[model samples]
Target: MSSIRLFILSSFDLLGPMHGHRLRIEAENRHVSLWTEISVGAVYGAMARLAEEGYLRQIGEEKDGKRPVKQIFEITEEGRRLLAELRRSGLTEIWYKHDPFDLALVRLDPASAAELPALLQARLKALEERLAEADRINAWAAPYIGVTKRAALKHGQHRLRGEIAYLREVLDDIDAIVAEVAAGKV
Candidate 1:
């Protein structure tokens, strides 16, 4: 199941009937991009697709001021059922992606030894910055978000911290690593 589909369905289920623009605004307000695959701008297309699939139905159209008419939508019973299935699958699934950095490290060439250290340092810095940003967002959102969202924020921070720690260890052993690579042992 797609996270975007889940997000769109859940938003409709919880927030009642809303137009695509409103849904997009809600997604942006919730900072869904930070943790989920849902793209704020894609909500319109997803809503249209869901309506076509019978998961959502267009209720009416409304025009506010000079703006064009907006088609409002509400979730169907099928959407509710689909949301439950999506939640179940999402909660039960475990995913781990292989980082390309691992492959590059394993294939490190002695000639690139000088570059590896700087590259690793840059990566470490980026991860550290991400962790800091996560912390800031968590702090800002704590008052408005529930425990589940807070947990997701923490999860991201934890992952960043783990990577930062690993990078530190690699930096500490940089000399040995370069030597091993130079000897064609890595």
Candidate 2:
């Protein structure tokens, strides 16, 4: 599913009529980038495309002081239908994206095996940093956000923790892994 499309349609459905600029601001304010694949810069383009596709319709235009006229838009019945479909698919789908690290692990040569520990250590460090940041964001947003958003934040944290634990286990067995790789048994 297109996250941008879902976000745009849902925002319109929930917030009434809004211009592209307002949508972009709302996306940023909601920290969509942190939780979803939506890019803040893509909001305007997506809005334009949604209008072209008849999912959205321009209702009016507003001018703020010297700024150019902004075209306000609202979701159509088609958009609402699309939004419902996206929500259903998104909630029901079990998406497990493949990580390149798994490929690298299976394809590791004896020489690369020796270097795996350092590389894994670096990745672990980065994941730790990300977890710390997630914690801070959760603490800051907990009072303002609903349970669903808090659950999303916790989901991200849990994934990071899982990876961190896996890395530590691998690191603990690095010597054995290197031996296996050297023996061409891995």
lDDT of 2 by residue, 1-186 (tens): 788998999999999999999999999999998788788999999999999999999999999999999999999999999999999988988878999988888789987887888898899999999999999988999999999999988988898999999989988988898889888887
Best by lDDT: 2
Error of 2 at 175 (Å): 1.6
Question: Which residue pairs in model 2 clash with each other?
Answer: none
**lDDT (Cα atoms) of all candidates against the true structure:** 0.91, 0.91
Candidate that would win on TM-score: 2
Residue ranges of candidate 1 with Cα displaced over 4 Å: none
lDDT of 1 by residue, 1-186 (tens): 688999999999999999998998999988998887677899888888999999999899999999999998999999999999999998988857899999999998889987888999999988988888989988999998899999988888888899999999999999889899988897
